[model samples]
Target: MQKNKQWNVKGAMRLAGTFHFLHSCASGCLLPFLTLYFRHLGLTATMTGIIMASRHMLALVWRPISSVLARQHDKRRAVVVGSLFSSASVVLILLLFPSEGLKAESGRCNASQLNANVAEDGGEFTTLENLPQFNATVYSVYNTTVVTEQSNDDDTAEYTPTPLISNSTRSVRKVRSLQEEHPHSEFLGSLKVMDAQHQMFFLVLIVTGFWEFMAVPLEWTADDGLYEYLDFVDATDRHRSAKIWKQLGAAFGNGGVGILVTGLYCLTGTTAEFYSYAILMILTVPAAALLPLYLRKRERRTSGGFKALQLVHGNSQALLCAVTVVLTGMASSVVSDFLLWQMQDHNATETHMGISLALAHFSQVGFVPLAGRLARFLKYHGWLLVLAVIALSLQCLYYSFLWGPWTVIPAQLLAGISTGAMWWSVESQCEDIATPGTEKTMFRVFELLSLELGAGFGSLMAGFVVQKFGLSVLFQGTALILALWSIALALLKWKIPRQRRINYSRLLAADMTEMSESDSDQEKDWLETAMDDSKQKNKWTMDKPSK
Candidate 1:
């Protein structure tokens, strides 16, 4: 009985759900916190953006290789390995967390010395503009010294070493003079200091990206595996059910983990928040290992990962889909990376920021099911994309003019539409059009490409914009892009030939029917062969009865 019930379609879905939930918990810990952590390290906006971009940018090289490996090896094993690496990366990030504080301490020491000098000068000016000029006179120090001389005949005399007199001019006055000579010297100086500080954090950023590249694909494979398993089992409402479970997991991760981490951050403070992240990442490893056990034998069989290539080429709709996905990603990155900053900019606490994020994720509980229902009606599969555009644009606009920390709650509630609807639509459409053996592989490839192009570039671009402009400009610019993209999508939909708007649901139903018939026929053939063999064995036994 235990053997008979070892695994089933429902069991596989449950496992997939578990994987998503744990994965979300791990990511939630990082997403809202990591960028702020960088800022806390005294890293400038550009460095923070670079770190965010690098997380996805590195996937460019690893994604293809990872997909190939998952196809060639056991995807479960691949995911387990990725989880272990993720855990390592989290621990390393935690270890490096103290470096920021140390650097800050060093800066404070420098400031203290300057303060002492100012106090000694008895300067009364309180502002940089009204600060008095320092005298440029050189200061000299003299000390007694003894000298020894040796004769040409190698005679030596003993002597005591003493400090030598020295005279040096302090550069403070020169720096002030230079400041007067060059109006932009302060900015230049700051830029130089920022460059130097970046050198220290660069390695940390690279290490952070390492696990992200590894874990993201592994998680995608596992997540997509569940959907593929549902298809293999010929489950009813596969698309909707799979998305519901996935979103449910996300809701749990985002709401529960988001609040937990936020509370931890507030309790332990920003400097120690990495500890919470590391602990959460450690939990993902065990969760990932359970994925393979849920898959049936046939589902576990290897197919080439590169099989996705057939669908990617010459598919115009898929191409358009990619464009929209990229736009959505760019807009989403602003919220994920800097929403906390925006909250703090409004004088909100970390707890308030966490609540806002939790609200966004929790809202998905309501919309994911709605997306599933909407999918039942749309034959073309593009309606969800439309919803995604409108919702995402609205969310971006809301964020652009966000009034308070509490405001993020509404913005994130709108976010549920974008995340739930877009993710469901993308996965469902890709699976709907994918070739039979390439569903899993195609999902992995598409996810990597879309996220890297969209979110990666978005973070990098946002960083540069934030550096040059400000956060307000960044949000407004992002909102404008999304708004224009939405208009473009509407126009594209209108231009589509009426005949070309195919009925995706009918195609999906036909595909399911064909698969079910094939399975039924195979089962019938196996049973008939078994009965014939049993009859032949009985005849042979009767023929040998005389013995």
Candidate 2:
């Protein structure tokens, strides 16, 4: 019996680890670069923000429906596998959309023209303000020169020119060109750009919405299933251990794909990030199927829907936790959706962003084990959340003052505390508060819903803020909000007396007792019914003999 129990525990842990690792691997491969990809496709900060916000908004609607379906139908594993497959399919659809943006192409000849003129004039060139026509003519001549040179040579020679436009000068030239173009030409060109931006925005919005619809449920459902399985096998402590593998997977995925994209970008001047995302997601589907999913055979008397709300309403600490989660989510979403954009503005490469994410995830491997000890030392899980929020605020503040792409590295190291440990605290609290039958539903509602709701609102606001105030102000503003929120949270914790911890072990024992008693009663009733039927059959047989 001991051997069998040990085998089951080991097998469950291994399978759970594999599932989390693969799922996180897929996330790491795509999520960090997703905003960068949008930028590459010529999406403005505002458009990207709207698209990301829409995804989270849609998730708020879809997640509840998914949770109910999984619970009522007892299909957590099926839902996980199906969500992975659907998400993979959605990523592939992104490839079919036009990758090139009209805006990105308009300035292609600006640098070449400037470089050629500078070379010809022995380092002095005409001011850009007076050179539109000259530059246009130079652009034509430069292309012609390159073609003639290539034709004359047996081997085709490539002419690559470095951009000489200072950032301020480039902006001035762009605005001046827009203003100085022939009125009708300008109108027509502006109209064309607007039409394309709007078209791409809607296309990306729809794809992102569908992608989130499929991807978001996998996390909650898989966690619920794995947790239930672990609880059933009396190995619930191993749940946190599984996250170690998840962190490792994310590290490898981000680092490996970042390197891959960087190398490919150098060679081909384009990235294969989306294709890599699709492949990783597809691979995750099979691993999800291998997870140990515990499905309840009997329906609960209490409905799973709105249970999280009920818990929050009844428990003061739970309410505080929910609010904290929302604040954390809001701050973190702004960072996740736009931090890379900010880094790129500072001339950060894909490699820098990738390494930053890789280091953050790798740090989580060390932090996950320490979460429990920290919580213990603090005397409450909520304190860990408070610390995490502080760390996040500091991270955002650090991001606002970035001097170079490499500077983003140190900030990412804080992710272990901000993201990993924060979630660990949240999950631990949810487990403590959840009732036996509604564990998964409560987790979905409390953790996922609150986080996503804040994320949606944050993204919506971030887009406009970034568009109007710039990335620096956006990060600074986020830092301010988080810092204030954390301070308030700490004050509240000090003011309120701590609630006595619920004895979950006793609760579980009582729940088991009720179930066992119910089973015994059911067996007794069945035995009585069988005996009565047997007696009736014998009586009927005796009467038939007389006939």
Pick the lDDT winner. 2
TM-score of each prediction: 0.68, 0.72
RMSD of each: 13.4, 13.6
Which segments of candidate 2 are over 4 A away from where they belong?
1-7, 74-77, 99-194, 267-271, 297-305, 431-441, 504-547
lDDT (C-alpha, whole model) for all candidates: 0.60, 0.72
Scored by TM-score, the top model is 2
Clashing pairs in 2: none
Candidate 1, poorest ten consecutive residues by summed lDDT? 134-143
Can you write out model 1's per-residue Cα lDDT over 1-547, one digit (the tens) per residue? 2554644666766665666666565556555677776765556677788888887777766766665466446555566556656654654554544433211112123433222223333312121112222111111111111112122222211211121111111233344467788977976543332323454466568677765765655654564455555555566355445455544544444455445544554244453445545565577666666664323444445554555655655466666677788788877887788777776666555567666676676677677657666877875567778778888877767776777758677777887788778877777757655765565566656666667768888898888887788788888888788778878886786675322324444444454454677674564455568888999999999889583
Worst 10 residues of 2 by lDDT: 121-130
Full-model lDDT, candidate 1: 0.60
Instruction: Kindly give the number of clashing pairs for every candidate.
Output: 0, 0
- Candidate 2 lDDT, 157-185, residue by residue in tens: 33322232233234444644776866556
